[model samples]
Target chain A: MIPARTWPLGRAGVHLVLILYTALCLGPVLLVVMNSFKSRAGIFGAPLSLPNAATFDLIGYKTVLGQGAFLRYFGNSLIVTAGSLAAVLLFGAMAAFALSEYRFRANRLLGLFLALGIMVPIRLGTVAILNMMVAARLVNTHLALILIYTAQGLPIAVFILGEFMQGVSKDLKDAGRIDGLSEYTIFFRLVLPLVRPAVATVAVFTMIPIWNDLWFPLIVAPGEATKTVTLGAQVFIGQFVTNWNAVLAALTLAVLPVLVLYLLFSRQLIRGITAGAVK
Target chain B: MDQIDKLAADVPLLPAATRDAAPARTRRWHIAVFLAPALLVYTALMIVPLADTLRLSLFRSVEHAPVFVGLDNFRVLLTDPRWSLHFWAAFRHNLYFFAFHILLQNPVGIALAALLSLPRLRGQAFYRTAFFLPTMLSFVIVGFTWKLILSPLWGVAPALLGSVGLRGWFHPWLGQEATALTTLALISVWQYVGIPMMLIYAAMLAIPGELIEAAELDGITGFAQFRKIKLPLIWPTVGICSILTFVGNFNAFDLIYTINGANAGPNFATDLLGTFLFRTFFGNQLQLGDPNMGATIATMMFLIILAGVAAYLFGIQTRMRRYAL
Candidate 1:
């Protein structure tokens, strides 16, 4: 009975810690977003407060939108991310299906070879990749980014999908086989539908990093026409460092879409990670 | 049905009907068809390039011609004081960055994860989402955002410091040689702490309630239970997190590059191995590009990562027995 008294105290302490930590996590982002809406003087004066009617300013937004190639960068990011995710998922799933389902002599060796990419950072191979891209005349194009990202993303995607595919019910495939369905038909018409959740997980896992990556974009596709959102914002903000309003506004603009997407899919994303997709 | 059963019994089972039987030629062809495209793409794009990078390290470019320099590029990178200083500085900086991450990021993550995992914690989902929000955003956002917040001109830092009545502590941290790298490392820690927290929280959840109850019965609760029981049990997860953190930190480039440029400056304090390699591969204002030198640097980076992974796998992993719940 005496020990019961300690429970409330413990609960209160836990709540206190969580609340404090949550504040720490949210504070900087909140400050940035709030200040992005205020005039420069208002931001400096009351950094903690929200934008008031009198202090409200869209000058920063106007400047950022006016000078930067924001829309083009956004479009480029979308194309690269979507293109890479599509290639990785399709190829990864197919390879995973074969590796998991078949009993070929070289099956283990093939899987091991694929797993090697997981450990070796793809950037280490940039020298040859650039040379190859130059030789193929693919530099300064979105195709360069897409191809590299697809290759980079495939190993983890295949690894995760393979693990998930191993747990798929074999009875369904067997039934398909007995019904005169071809192996290809079984994989596509039946197996693919069942693995939609894993697909979502893989998409989330692969999309964020590719969208956020800076190296390949800077090296292989840094042309003005091919700049990704990340590189675009970095350059834009660097060029206008002294313009406080524009800098804050550009940073906010860069952060907003991802923030919205994250809030929408946060659960699925966390679920995927905790599900051991990368582990 | 009786006649059909009798007919089936009269015939022996075909080889294909057996569970462990070899697949027919047609099925084998199907396997190859499914596997070929992905293998072709992965090998052509990833494997071939990696091998070529290693091979390129052994050769030098001479007047639009390639000459085999063998170990000369590597020797210059390692032995010559000019290149070696930047290489070693970046290497040491990377190690320091990694050490800071392990010390601060992992512990803070573990602590936050522990609190979040409390069985009856209120607003758990909200806390989880908020904690993870920064991680989903791009490094550009994180880098520039932190830079603005800490900028002395912006007064955001001063204001926050003023609230706590410690306004004298405000300085331009990102501009200081001593503080720049550490400050950036801390920012990175802030952005990524969510990952380890969520992972560790998941591992903690996998621990059974019965074990907690048993530990509680033995008069262990809170931190005591964590240290005495939970810590040992979560060591494997921690191990995995450590190695992941090692690789990620060693490979990290964007944040520093975005925040500090390829020079990684304010006197190169923030320069890491990634930035160093980037500068070497794509020549900066001060130097012409050297592919052989860049390849040598990359090979060294690869070796470092390999050694670290090997240490984790053989040295740390084998010693810790993962508890099966």
Candidate 2:
């Protein structure tokens, strides 16, 4: 039998602290989700109680579906996020590969230059970005958000993926070179697949901020047709602030897609984030 | 497993200095091809806009056209009573916002990480996922969720407090002048504590098991073991997390804007640089939007962030890199 551990906190104590925090973190979210399924009276009258027959209602979801073009907003977000992520992965990986594999004079300087955005937010230039978007007639376009997200994601992508690519064996690339495979083919067929885990990590990291962002969408795409789901929820909630059921349902709708996707990819996300962040 | 699958933690992304440069300079077209797409998009959207924002700050729009008015925008922002009052208040509130994050969020995150890292803990996976759930949700969801929970009319906060014999402590936190900003800060902490916890946990896991076992053999265990052995090794992760929190807080807007509205209401008690910038750029009932003055505020934010980042990269990070092992 293992000896009892000598610690300031007993095992039970540790578990208690964890449980309390878990509740604090999860209680509000669960409260919102459950109440979204309840009637307005049910929500305020019995806030913590799980939905029963008396409390169950679909009115909130109906209001949300009837009013907001949330589906269209979801489509816009999907387009922008997927497009930007694809661009970030391809462009960011290529840049990372070049910086890592090629021994050049300006390589370090270039790497440092690209890494600047990791610390400094791209939002600082929103004024000029809006100007450029209007001038280019790209305002209210998914392309505008996608291009900005690509730039936003590239720095950290290069930072993380560059590290992973540096560890890819030089021998394999050299063997491919000897096999007379073109360099581009080597990158596509060789390096990218080899760095699949890192790419997964980068995808989740790059996808999140783009998805949850309200600022650019609010500024560049506030028109009814161009709203992303996040901006849609914000606008919807703002208009329906007094309508509790609709507000909760709107937030729940905004939340469900991300939560569902996260549940599906949690393993990959957890592994990838932990691996990619290694010092 | 192939070599790539056997990733190790010790390797840095880019090495310090390579003495042997590659000899093939003739067929170098792929290099530009590899880099230009990313560079072009990044420069056009990021670098060019940043430069133009700086330039725009030095100009004023006269009859829908920009006219160069050097230092005048800065003077107005600093000295003009109309602009300066809001500017100074927002600046002061932003510091308070950052302080609450640093003092509260980092410590709580560190504590949770320590507990989660304990040996033989049950439900670790569930707790990790659950804690990170709020972080995954958009700030809109988080803000509204907390808003409903803390609403006095909804009675959840009051009822819970009463159950625990502290009903009087419950107030309309989001609507009160004295408590509004702190309430928002705590709500934000709840949403984001997962980040630092996860980062530190990752760093802790990266610590070699044998090293920990060796410490146990030396009769150093539990909190003492953590204090002496684990804490020193994990300082770099803590440092990184702290800086991340600083950057995130200074750049924060969504929660305050969503829960408190863009006016940062309760008489501007919760106004931050981000919300201030948003109000200036976009305008509200009281003020019409002015892009030049907005750019001026953005430039100031840029310089402040630059100073913090430069200090971290040069001062703290270099020192911590040595302790990362």
State the C-alpha lDDT per candidate: 0.86, 0.87
Report the lDDT tens digits of candidate 1 across residue range A1-279: 224322423877777877888888788888888888989888777777899997799999999898898989999999999999999999999999999998889999999999889989899999989999999999999999999999999999999898888888999899999999988899999988888888998998899999888889989999999999888888899999888788888888888888888888888888887777224
How accurate locally is residue A43 in candidate 2, as Cα lDDT from 0 to 100? 88
**Candidate 1, residue A253: lDDT:** 87
What TM-score against the true fold does each predicted structure earn?
A: 0.95, 0.94
- The positional error of residue B300 in candidate 2, measured at the CA in angstroms, is 0.3
List runs of model 1 lying over 4 Å from the truth: A1-9, A277-279, B1-22
Q: Write the per-residue lDDT of candidate 1 for residues B246-310, one digit (tens) a residue.
A: 98986689999888899999889999999999899899998988888888888888889989999
How far off is each candidate at the interface, as Cα RMSD in Å? 2.5, 1.4
Which docking class does model 1 fall in?
A: medium
Model number with the top DockQ: 2
B315: Cα error in model 1, Å: 1.1
| Candidate 2: clashing pairs of residues | none
